[model samples]
Target: MNRLAILSVSDKTGLIDLARVLVESYQFQLISSGGTAKALKEANLPVTKVSDYTGAPEILGGRVKTLHPKIHGGILSRPDLESDRADLTANDIQPVTLVVVNLYPFEQTIAKAGVSLEQAIEQIDVGGPTMIRAAAKNHQYVSVLSNPAQYNAYLEELKAHNGETRIEFRRSLALAAFSHTQAYDRAIADYLTKEILNEAQAKIDLMEVSSTGATSSQPSLSSSYTLLCHSPKPLRYGENPHQPATWYQLGAAPKGWSAAQQLQGKELSYNNLLDLEAARSIVAEFWNDAPCAVIVKHNNPCGVAIAPTIAEAYQKAFAADSTSAFGGIVALNRPIDEETAKALTSTFLECVVAPACVASVATILAAKPNLRVLVLPEMQQGTSETVKLIAGGMLVQKSDDLPATPETWQVVTQKQPSPEQMQELIFAWKICRHVKSNAIAITGDRVTLGIGAGQMNRVGSAKIALEQAGDRTKGAVLASDGFFPFDDSVRTAAAAGITAIVQPGGSMRDGDSIKAADELGLVMVLTHVRHFLH
Candidate 1:
């Protein structure tokens, strides 16, 4: 009695090789479906189509192929139980020892541009996941393989065990199969929710055709969320030395923080990753062919600047707050040239992350043994939901990837801002958006003079920012993450000699703040875009 092996897969990565080995080395009967059957037949291997084995033709566009009792009975039969043995004999079902299957490319299909809902629905492999789950659930008597990469080792194991697979290997393959199906279903669910939200947004746009410039797109609620967690690599230490940590990658393709490849330096610490993310997020805002640099300390932007050249940007960003730049994370929008690398190496920086680095420049940074150099092309543009863990459940939200413009703000003050003042205010607004709650950013000449973040009160943050600006506060502009609840902040800014201010004006006493600005001879702009980063 030859053991039966079911080979049904959408991905033909190692189908022929695995089929030939199972047939020749292991002496197993090949049972395949659809494309897998076609490929195996082309290889001149003796194969039985799943429909032929089940005596049921695939109907309803091949959706009804593997849902038959004959196909599942073989994989699910328990040879130990008398009832299970009788059922298998009554159905003339042979025990299926191996199931080589992989799900359809649902994620890749939907990721393509201009894909339709119907098209994506078709790509959702109904029978593939069904078979995978069935085999995985009955892993005691069945072996499941979902990835083609498992072929060589599985063949080796069978060859070693005299055409028999161990329970441990079978259980691991079952786990992999289950993970594959879960990820597939998750991709389909996420894509469907996205489509529904897009359609809903389209309807809203149709209803409010006049409301064009508002925040049109938001991540809508989905039924379920799934993350394919894998690739666990050990780290030196966690946030603290006593705590243990391991780095895990989510999904197959690398993006954002997961995409960073460290080139030169000591091993990355837990705090190092946090600062890197903050710097990357900030610099990504100015990644549009501009030379922008951001210096981050403890997950807050201490210095940020944009200049004609990357070296100049790094210089201006460093000059913004030299005290905080020491031992801080540096992120650049442009590649590090020789000049920029030399300038960066001059500082006592912790890490330098960019899209690319010249070989010689990487060598120049190599001179600093402790400086971590990371190259991440995905930093330029990528979309991912922000998920944070709480006490019992999780909080999911859309990332604040909204684009800002100087034109969107309303000039509310009697003393309207000058053209340069508006530009300065917009630049300040962009930085303030990323700062912690009760944040204040003071800027002049396209650079941050000072930032007061995570203060308990808006006035306290404003005072700190103004004081940090010091002499520069006389001509600098100010931006607040939220609207000032009281007029005292306005008075404080004006007293600091701040010329212009930008904030989201939604407070009940907006008139009082406006009156204070008017009385103090100050220019104020209301962005109506409150960015409270708590």
Candidate 2:
């Protein structure tokens, strides 16, 4: 009896070649179903239709074609066991040696612009995953291939071992098959979660308008969900040298940092990625504004500025705190030009990311061989949900990406800010939200003068930021992430020459701070929304 190979796939990328090799060179019998069988016959390769081999007609619109006992028994049988061999022989089933299968395009179907739920459900593969899992679970007796990219390697393995695959090679292929099914299941679960939640919200909106009963409570988060990550790339180390680290991409398709184009420099470390995300978030806040630049150190924005020219923005941001800017991560809203590239090379930095760069900018940046440069055009796009890991389980929440509405803010002081001061306050508030609490940021002329973050007390943070600004605090504005519980910070800001202040005003003693601002002739604006990043 000839060894049998089953070929069933939704993506027929390398199917013809693999089938031909198996039939002509290895003398293995081929069995296929539906479109795969049609494709093999069209390619002039000999194959046995799965229905013909199993002696059962395909039922339920081809959904029950491969769920027969003959197909699964052949795949799960043990050749060394007497009972298994007897069952196979009694049923006249050929023991399957190779199984090649790939799942349907469920992810692609849902990614369509206006795909309906029924359309997505129809694309979900049932028999395919079943066949794959069975083959993977019986890896000791069979070899399974779940991806088109594995075909060439499978051929190489067969050739290396004299027309047979080694046990270890089969084990690795089984692992790949299991991972493929797992990722497919996760995608389906996530899509259903979103769809079900949106549907529930729509019904609630309908009820609120029609019914006279008490209002319904908001829908809570899903009780459980799965997260799948693939393509693990090893890194040098994590935050410290002793800790090992690896980068795992979230999905099969790359986006965000995984899709970044690295123009030059060495690989990014764990800390570099963290700082880069912080820098990206800060720069994203000013994407619609003028040319903007942000410099981050230890995952906190040390400098952020917007200027008429990209080079000027970078220069002013660097001038915000030159000492801390050293070896910091940089993110820019505009493309890098000649002047900006020249200024960038003058300093030793860890990384620089931008929307794009001129053709000549690469050569200019070549001076710093160790600087990791990246280009991500869609810098404004971010994850809708943020996930954090705690002791045993993880926490999930909506990302704090609300827009800044300075127009809705109220003037809580006797002195009102000028138009220029209002713009400065808006800029300061946008940057303040990204800083770690207790956070305080001072800005002048649309550039960060000084930022104090992660302090124990609000007053300590204000003092650090004011002292960093020094003389620049004259005519500058200050923005705080939270409300001030006391008037000491307000008095201190006025004494440091801060002309305007912006903060969320929900504190019990807010009147004390307002009275101090009025007495000192300083402008105070209350936004009514507090942003605390810990």
Candidate 3:
């Protein structure tokens, strides 16, 4: 008996060709619905409308077309069992040996500029998924094809195997079809639930819903957002020996890093990704009209400097902590020129990331074959959620994107900051806010001289920052990431000839600190909000 094939598709890329082969060579009767039937009819192919075979007219604006018994019975029937054949005969249902279907343009509909929820809802294919699932359930006999990418290979296999596609191939295609439907349903359900129903709901809600409803039975916290993790590739190893790690991309739809063209280098490790993230963030802060150098060690900036020339910036940043930067990751805001590359090659560094690496510069770096070179086209965009794993759960917060403007700055001292001091104060404030707290950064000539981060006390951080600045502290401006709990921090900075100070003045001893600043003839400004990056 001739096999029955059903073809229903929203994307008719290679539909006509496939239909021609199925009809002429395989002698498979084509059953189609709506647009697919119309397309086949237009091409003058012998096609049976699904409603005709099902003995039911398309109803409810075509929604009730394929949900009838005849279509589903043929799709769900098991050809191996005699009882299944008897039931098919009793129901007057011809076994649907093959099903080729692709759903409506839900992805395309969502991608449209001003698509509404109603429009998106309408595009969700009920019949298409139902038919695909029915076919997949009988994968032992029925071959299901949902993607056009599988068309040519499937046709070749059918031609080679005397119109009988292999069970293995059919099973794989069935799996793909199910996955396609699952991802499709997920996109629609997620869009409606998150965007239309609750705009403020976390992105993880979709994943949680999918996990609960789908095959994956993983439990998820109601309050927590779901992190869509993808390991693009395996890494060399982790941070240290005896620890295994892999880099995971965060977003459900990744545009960069995970998709970036890795022109050269070995596999990236967990620490590599952490250092790269730090380098990318720091370089992004100074990308526009400024040459900046950022040396990152363990997801924290060891040194960062801005200058007229990339070489000078690298030199100043490296000089800040040569020991820490020995095997660190270096990022440049500007393009890597020959001079910059030469300076970079002089030192032994683990990785270098920039927007563009010059041909000559790339050739120079090629001397050190193991040095990982990455050309990031754009800086990493800031995320909306910040996640930190606690003992048993996770702590979540809205990312700190607090704007630092001159209007927001408050001058709390008897001696206000000079105009030059105000410029450096704002610059230092911006840099210090991004560093780990308790944080202190000393800046001069639009470049960071020293930074002290993640310390116990604010004064201890200030002293460490000043000590690193050394002679550079004389004319440098200092910024404390948070308030000075005591007047001693003010006295310490004053003795270092710090010139000016910027901090969040919430301390009860603010008057004493102001008095100390006045005695040293230091310029002091207070920003009401404290930025502690830890």
Candidate 4:
């Protein structure tokens, strides 16, 4: 009896070559299903369909094709066991020596625009995973090829060993097969979780219209959902020297932090990853044709600016606080052109991140071999949940993705901000949300003049930011991450020649703060929403 190779795949890359080699060189019988059978037959190879091999027609719209005893028994039989061998011979089922199977495109299905729940669920592969696991579990006498990329290497092994596979090679292939199945299941779970969350949101919307019922399984409140985040890449160190760290990307499809590919320099440290995400998140806020740059240090935005061109954006953002921009992480929204790359090299920056870089500019950045450069195309899009670990429990919350519009901004002060000033105020508020608590960012003409982050007191942050602004404070507007408790911050701003202030006006002493802004001739706007980053 000839050794058999089972081939069932969604991706048909290199399938014909693998099938021809198995038939002509290895003298192995070929069995396939659905599209794989059609593809192999088209190539003029003698391929057996799973349905025909099992002597049973497919049922339930091709879902129950390979779930029969003949298919599983052949792949799962133990050659060493007399009873298993007898069962296979008595059932007239030929032993399956090699299994080539790849899962359905569940990730690609859900990724389509406006994909429905039914469409997503239908793409989940049942028979493919089952066949893969059956072969992998019996790897002692079976070889499972779970991916098309494995075909060339498997063919090379047969060529080297004269149509025989080593035990070690089989074990490695089994491990790869297991990994593929696990990643496929994880994608399915993530899609289902998002579906549940979407339905829960719909329930909330219905409740807002008329309070009637509540959803039992709210994604935000439930802790039982299987949230999968695999693919761990070890890092050099954590935030400190003695601690260890690793980077684990969430989900199967690459996006956000997982999608960023480090092109050069040392491995990303924990602090580097933190600052990189902070810088990228700030840059993500400005999703438009205009170029924008954000500089982050200690996980806070020190400088940020948007301009007509990439170079000027980098120049203005760096000039915001040249002292802080030194050795800081830089993120750009647009592709890094030669001019921007040249401007960036003028400062001793720690890292430069962008969606894409021109070839000439990448060559320019390559000069500084130690500078960490990342090219992540997914930076242009993002929407995620915030997960936090707390004492004896976990805290899950919605990301602070609220937009600041005119309807949400109330002119609480007797002095309302001018149209131009209002735009600048909103811009400052957007940047402030990304800054750490006790944060104050002074802005002028839509560019940050100075930022004080992680200060012990609100007044301290205001003073530092004002001091950095100096002459620029004459026309600059101030944005606080939280509400002001006392009039001291207002008095400090007045003394520094600050023209306007934006804060969440929720403190009991809000009256005093409003009065101080009125007396100082400062335009104060209250955004009922509070953005507190601790």
Query: What's the TM-score of each model vs. the native?
Result: 0.88, 0.93, 0.74, 0.83
Model 4 scores what on Cα lDDT? 0.86
Candidate 2, TM-score vs. the true structure? Answer: 0.93
Off by over 4 Å in 2: 59-61, 156-162, 165-169, 209-214, 217-221
lDDT of 1 by residue, 1-534 (tens): 998999988889888888888888778999988888899999999999988999999899887788888888988888898999999989889988888888778777766889888888888888888888999999998989888888888998888898888999889988888777777777667777778888878876776766564545556476556676656778888888899988877665555677688898898888898788888788877877468899999888999998899999999999989999999999998888999999999979999998899887857887898889899986856556678889988888888887786677788888977788887887888889889988999999888998999999998899888888898888889999899899998998888889999998999999999999999999999988878886
> Least lDDT summed over 10 consecutive residues: which range in candidate 3?
215-224
How well is each residue in 80-174 modelled by candidate 3, as lDDT tens digits?
89999999999899998889999888866776789888888889899999999999988998999898878898899998998788889999998
Model 2, position 14, has a per-residue lDDT of 91
What is the C-alpha lDDT profile of model 4 across 414-506, one tens digit per residue? Answer: 888889999889889989989888889999977898888889999888888888888998888999989999999898898888889999989
**Tens digits of per-residue lDDT for model 2 on 1-534?**
789988899999999999999999899999999999999999999999999999999998887889988899999999999999999999998899999999889987887799999989888899899889999999998999999999999999989888999889999999999989989988988888789888988878888888575466556655676677877889899999999999988876778899999999999999999999999999999999999999999999999999999999999999999999999999999998999999999999999999998998888999998989999999998878789999998888889999999889999999989999999999999999999999999999999998999999999999999999999999999999999999999999999999999999999999999999999999999999999998
Give all candidates' CA lDDT scores. 0.86, 0.93, 0.82, 0.86
Global fold similarity of model 3 (TM-score): 0.74
Question: Best-fitting candidate, measured by TM-score?
Answer: 2
**Candidate 3 stretches greater than 4 Å from native:** 1-71, 74-87, 94-125, 128-186, 189-224, 228-231, 240-253, 389-395
Tell me the alpha-carbon RMSD of every candidate.
Answer: 3.7, 2.3, 7.9, 4.1
